[model samples]
Target: MRKEAQELYRAEKDKIVLRPFTAKYPKIAPEESYRIQLALIEMKKADGAKVVGKKIGLTSKAMQKMLNVDQPDYGHILDNMVLPDAAVFLAGELIQPKIEPEIAFILDRELTGPGVTPTQVLAATRFVLPALEIIDSRIEGWKIKLCDTIADNASSARVVLGNSPKRVEEFDLKLIGMVLEKNGDIVQTGAGGAVLGHPAVAVAWLANAVGQFGVSLGAGEIVMPGALCAATDVSAGDLLQASFDGLGTVSVRFA
Candidate 1:
């Protein structure tokens, strides 16, 4: 597992895609995958990376069903993974980069529990921001199973956060609407409810899920509940923007 972790770590650093571990380790369990992810994270930390937050993936029922998983997966978000809204970057720098719009929570209070509720998640949240998650896979051609993705840090790459921040009580997140546009054309539209019925519910699940590992969703850390829609492919010279009903817009440019 440690050797596999090293391979994944090197893949990210070298921007190289690798064959899915499942091809060789077909019987790999989800638990083993998470352990590999943790080991990979430790490798990043040892090299001076700082964990700034956490990201939850596969929150939608459709995604879970497609992945043959019953629950969402998580990955640590490092400080370097964050980018400002309207940022531009080279497309060739990433391996199979894609984008997903999400609601990000900046917690005001620490949340730790084996049974955290959505209400508690809201209480602990300081504000929610419009976000764009740039997801990439270290696995070749993005062929991955549940265990494959779990071990690849949930395929997290970069995050772009919007300027607007609103408290949970300000609006009903479950009904919040979002429209994704690429090159000035609408590509996808979705509602927050697509994410585990409500985004906060997913956050609550994350808090409890990680609690079993003795990890707490810390105060002031950004927590991305999940994507509102399917991720869209990214390419050079492309401009993408996501507009939420009340959260304003966040965008990125691929150079």
Candidate 2:
């Protein structure tokens, strides 16, 4: 990253308390965008936030093609970004909130390095749970290039994990289906295959990418393996539900 670009990135990140950035700075390349993201992560760490785990984005082939990226991208999810079940999220805190259904893996062992396989991810995982990711684009309307989204923490906002956890061997995850319901009506449907052929593959991609940054997936960290379906716009008073076959269901009500 150029010195001027780095300075601008840091300035924008430090000004988070004022208001999130709703537009992108022009001429930022993909690599430079990741540099800004890492810098922001460092800034957050300096402010006392603990890195919880990573989030994989654009795991779906459609999303990958739409974003014109061949592979997935990841972002750091801070501990403070997690919300427990039944918790309320102030609508005003987010810029443009969209919801996605995903499968979250809680690791029982640390995973690092490239060439990690999907089988390895399944073995390292303690359990898998249904998750609803509230993705708030600091960039307005969630409209931005791949680099813009990456710099914005893959549009991460808050993640809600379901109570029940299913063992990896207990279900046929590759064929698992997910139904997304809004206000009691099904809005979208998808399957684990929608996420880079399988959710575990997404985890593998995330593990490798994090390794490149000199980070490793730690035990007990929650890794969200991207969304199984396209994001749905959310509104206050709305009820969102995601049900995964055999794994279980997770729901949240907007206030």
Candidate 3:
């Protein structure tokens, strides 16, 4: 079942949007879904994919409620999945894609725990930066339940990280603001608090949750805490930019 699911997803990567797993099978346990996620990622690793970092998703209360899931999910970040600052992402390479402005935590030290605190997350962080997490789901029409999303690697696609990296103490992250623009026009705006009250809160939540599965957030790993607002849709030839109040801006052109 695992290999079949993995091959199904691999074969249909950007070819067809898929039905939710729940729609096609009996209710799946979150643990089972996560196991499938690990298997798929491992398959990618066997194909020479390198682990770069991790991403936390569904951290917002609104997102949780929308998916009817009370807990957050995580996805692995591969070295090849990271685009340079302002890099263009080929629209032809994705299914249905969306973008969200977020704060990324670059860790200075390994963080592992079932009791990791936001303070610990901040203390271990080397710095933070403005980022845009490009999300794409293999799920058809984005009709996904929590298990479906979890099994699909939390719908992660790629990340566009900004250039300027600032120390956590250099600015107040919770009060930081952001303006998201598409094609040079502002389309959405938000503050850091929109991410589980504060962005680091999500990071802390991730460390503790994933740690239960024996995943340790390593030093030098980049952690995407979650989006600050609702995500914006993207299309070919659209240029998207996010400007943070303190952190500089990062842009991506869909081509």
What are the C-alpha RMSDs, in order, of all predicted structures? 1.2, 3.4, 1.5
**Sliding window of 10 residues with minimal summed lDDT for model 3:** 4-13
By TM-score, how accurate is candidate 2?
Answer: 0.88
Ranking by lDDT: 1, 3, 2
Expressed as tens digits, the lDDT of each residue in 84-142 for candidate 3 is: 79897898888888998899999999999799999999999999999999988888888
RMSD of 1: 1.2
Each model's TM-score? 0.97, 0.88, 0.95
Q: Per-residue lDDT tens digits of candidate 2, residues 202-240?
A: 899888877777878999999999988888889788889
Global Cα lDDT for candidate 1? 0.92
Which candidate tops TM-score?
1
What is the Cα-based lDDT of residue 44 in candidate 2? 73
Q: Which one wins by lDDT: 1 or 3?
A: 1
Which parts of model 3 are misplaced by more than 4 Å? 11-14, 65-69
Reference-based TM-score, model 3: 0.95
Rate residue 68 of model 2 by lDDT: 60
**After superposition, candidate 2 runs with Cα above 4 Å error:** 1-27, 65-70
The number of clashing residue pairs in each candidate reads 0, 0, 0
